[model samples]
Target: MVIVCCSILIISCIAVVSSGMKVSLEVDRPWLRVHLSQRAALECCYRTGAASLRTTWFVHNQPANGTAVPVPVRASDQVSSGYRMRGGVTCGTLTFAEVKVADSGLYRCWFNDAGVFTPGTYLQVYEPLKKTINLSEKTKDNILMAEGFLLLLCVLVPSATLLCKSKQLHALEQKKATREEENIYQGLDLNDCDKAMSLYQDLVANEQEEIQLENP
Candidate 1:
């Protein structure tokens, strides 16, 4: 009877082991960093199985083997470990109360019953970037401004050239007209007898009219 009871117990244990569920870790955020008004928090959740699941936290700081720290599915006062349960999912959070430069590394949450792991989350702790200029965007703006100026120049240059050419043509026409008038005056011949006689008669008539006005 003792042998039969032992067999039954063994069979029950086996059945329980076989009924254990496979689990997967769910990460809330993959990237963590130190920022103003924001604390560093890493959360991973997994569904509960028929049996209590074993969870482990691994931190890969160096190229060698990582440090494995077992995590209980219970809350702790320690700054490195914490747990919470919601909607049938158990979530484990690792909090860095005081983020350090050395905290920048890869972290992983592993589930043993489900034989699955959460992808590594890279945590970065550093000084926040200050307000500064974006040179790339500024450069693009400057290039566009320069292109606009060049386009304006391209339009104005041809217009100025055409204006100058018109002025030159107008000046040439004026000079040609003056030259033609001078040539016509030079071509007149006062030595012609009829022209000389006509000029003498006009002079005599002008002198007689001035004398008559003076006497009257």
Candidate 2:
């Protein structure tokens, strides 16, 4: 009787497994190949399965190879050894929000039955672009990075030109100011020399007048 029951159980497991699902991950295909920073969704779906079906979504593959993932009522699940919780199994679908590049992976979704429930789905996650990404945006970083390298040119180009122009203009102004100061000092010295010479000449004239008066 036990042998018969075991055989029946095995056969029933096979039958459940044979009722396989046509599964796929769903997202806008064009955005799949992009490199970006903003968030997007790596929407998991059993595209051909009916809503009446019950399933479970998992992060890392469970031991015993294909155990059903426990659906969390809250936004969290007991974090697996290497998996951080970012997605939830809703109905029969898995949804990850604020999708980053790290979110890319095979997400195994299985029907709640005993056998390794058909085939699981794989999700290729990615980050979304804030704006349209293009060659210009890619090159912009390199251009901005290279700006640091050309800093000598940036500073010297305009500064040297301005310095050259101002140097010439201020050269004449500085020279004129220096010349005026020297001229003022020289004039003062010359006036003092002239006054001394005139005083010496007056003394000689007075002495000669005395000599002439004595001789006459």
TM-score for all models, in order of appearance:
0.44, 0.28
How well does model 1 score by local distance difference test? 0.66
- Number of the top candidate by lDDT? 1
Write candidate 1's Cα lDDT for 1-216 as tens digits.
Answer: 345434533553454347566443453465676754345788777665544466676665644455544333223442467578887888877776666675667666655555545655668877777869657888989999999999999999999999999999999999999999999989888778678999999999999999999994
Those runs of model 1 whose alpha carbons end farther than 4 Å from true positions after fitting are 1-24, 33-38, 50-54, 62-78, 111-116, 129-216
Model 1 residue-pair collision total: 2
For candidate 2, give the lDDT of residue 32: 35
Best by TM-score: 1
lDDT per residue (tens digit) for residues 9-89 in model 2:
455447555766433322312223324343333332333343334545544323466663433322433222112223332
Per-residue error for 170 in candidate 1, Å, reads 15
